[model samples]
Target: MPVQKENVSTAISSDGGSGVSSDRLQAVARGDNIPAEVHKSVFETTPVLKINAFNLWYGTKQVIHNISMPIPRNQITALVGPSGCGKSTLLRSVNRMNDLIQNVHIAGDMQLNGDSIYDSRMDVIDLRKRMGMVFQKPNPFPMSIFENVVYALRIDGEKNRSVLEEVCEISLRGAALWDEVKDCLNDSALKLSGGQQQRLCIARAVAAEPEVLLLDEPCSALDPIATGKIEDLIQELRGQYSVLMVTHNMQQASRTSDYTAFLYLGRLIEYGPTSDIFTNPVLRETESYVTGRFG
Candidate 1:
């Protein structure tokens, strides 16, 4: 395992929670996709998350090797890998969710807006609040839909019915489900269809006001139409939050991510702009997997 870095700021946290203190993220000029200029935007525009030499293990067995990558500010970075490739494990490490599982050990430097997640000074509660996650299955809390969205806010000591209601509306709207569920906020989340339930989970994640959103196969259990809705929601969220998604679906990765990291057998085999990965993969493994030759 790599030695973990001390707490540090990867980017400046400005007014928009962009993590960069600068205001120089000029929109990329006409280009093939993300050019060198766009890569530079990580520093100028403020990357919301940065993971450097991050490694993790369960008990004494290592899962993720030394993996280092930058998640661009306000863009989606999809982690695509075959089964047992550590994509989900890597995602959990970002938010330290693995810490909750027994015998699970971590050796990594996961930085959210410049602070190492393992740093002793790092507050897990606050860290999780800033880096919310949506799981593979839509596990809505057994409560009213409104309550699910308000759970975190309430945990953070937010009271006042009017304030909660307003924030709930905003979050649901942001998840693109307010129009569908506006009339039934008080209904049980379990009553909704699979797609609506998934969107409700998204709303709950968003309600926490996280800067980085980690999704683990968020559409794996949904129908095509529902998947499209989630994809659209992810697109609409690009500018407001940095998204890191784990997906086995190659086409979905190509369609939704700005950058893609291809992992195999616990190693990050390729990491680059999505267009390049799809059109011209550099590694034999990446090309084979993305081209449907073999996972």
Candidate 2:
């Protein structure tokens, strides 16, 4: 059902903040087909990835509705929403990771640097090569740190030791982990602390020199200190790599992302600059969700 003007006006007058009624939020949670309120500023920046009318289904169940947005180049974009809202599903779709799930299907298209992502003629491996992905938890290969960082190059048949060493050092420096592990490059990656392991995983991803980095709750499994470190690294990555991240921490999203997209019940609710979405949203639903009044 479409949002009624009376309901919105009444809610705005009744509540000084958020200005969203419980009935309206409930309607959204019920899978109602409310149109997404995308702000104009979202298109002001050059997009490295564009999602156009994207939809996804797991077997017969639809999870992602007709969502569309542009991820700005060399900026961090955060996808924020309650659990089970298809944030991670949409992130994985960028690299075609969703194809691994049985009975999963998607319609619409995502373009990376103007190339169609869902096109049948596209090379899945090549597509993945252009993007780097980090998961919820730190997943470092059991091999030595050096081996772990250079795994992608090895897979591509890189045999020169000097080239591997140079790339490993550069990637580790980029991930801000070189000074700590420089002497122990041969140590097992599993032996590192939780935060170090996560940074190592980031270094591994960076070694590929991907066009975009996909982070799925990269700091969710760590302690506050580790999370802070990861957040710092994410900030350092801005202007160097286009980052599309799914995060549940509101403060983290506001602190790290340039653009923020809020989703509910598999539908996009609002998307725009982080400052506007958090401080002066175009819709009360967005304000309510961001201010913790409702979700």
Candidate 3:
């Protein structure tokens, strides 16, 4: 297979957990603000997203190779690749959205907290709750702004007025949109601007307290200023939640992520700390792409 471009994994057969393997994918341990050597702290004690020998196929076309990597807790991990290289495909795999496709076949193991999410016994709803997704375009409900954030919580069986309002407030604040829309909670969400609506979607994602937040080209729809606002929001979200974003913008990946993984034709060519990946890549493909050699 050219660069791990195996068949795309089918969500029906996939556990949908994230990461490469427990041992190889865990977050690097023992860093003091930063570390000098990338390989020394290879041993990981805690990891939030783990995948092992994962392969996927959309009917007959393979997308992701036998890719493996660990997502550190409460930090941003960016997936960068050229168009049609399966960046979005791999991101969707994390939450099992691939199952919605017509023909899908998934192979390999994915784990969360050492539990197999692909196992048939796993609760799909709960699994989705643990992994929230924010799309490129904001898709707020037609209802009031308040309902947009409260909708997910309502589904999770929280009917209490007080609890719902509290979650709404906290989630909006977490998404950096509360103060802007706090006064018009009852207003229709459509009245908001593009950036505001995107933040609203983010608020909606966080309302359920998801463990990992998946963002698919979220800022591609916004302008520079709005993009900055979303970037700032991601930084604020780091300490409280894990974030995985797929983007073609190299600058955005450099600015926002703690770790960066470069994929070429669906195979992960390199994965490492953002600083090293940007400043001094260990792989030839990464160097070429980062240095404008080729994508």
Winning candidate number (TM-score): 2
What tens digits encode model 3's per-residue C-alpha lDDT throughout 82-166?
7877899988988888888988888886777677868889887778888889999989999999999999878878889999999
Task: Estimate the TM-score of every prediction.
Answer: 0.83, 0.93, 0.85
1-295, model 1: which lDDT tens digit per residue? Answer: 4223223233434454434211111111111122111223334545678877777778888777677777888889999877988999889888888889989876668788888889999889888888779998899999999999999989989889999999999999999999999998899999999999999999999888888999999999999999999998988887788899999999899888888888765666667778877886544445556887656
Score candidate 2 by lDDT: 0.91
Q: Show where candidate 2 strays beyond 4 Å.
A: 1-20
Best-performing candidate as measured by lDDT? 2
The lDDT per prediction is: 0.79, 0.91, 0.78
The collision pairs in model 2 are none
RMSD of each: 13.3, 3.8, 11.2
Sorted by TM-score, highest first, which candidate order results?
A: 2, 3, 1
Give me the runs in candidate 1 sitting further than 4 Å from their true place: 1-45
Query: What local lDDT does model 1 show for residue 91?
Result: 90
How many clashes does the backbone of model 2 have?
Answer: 0
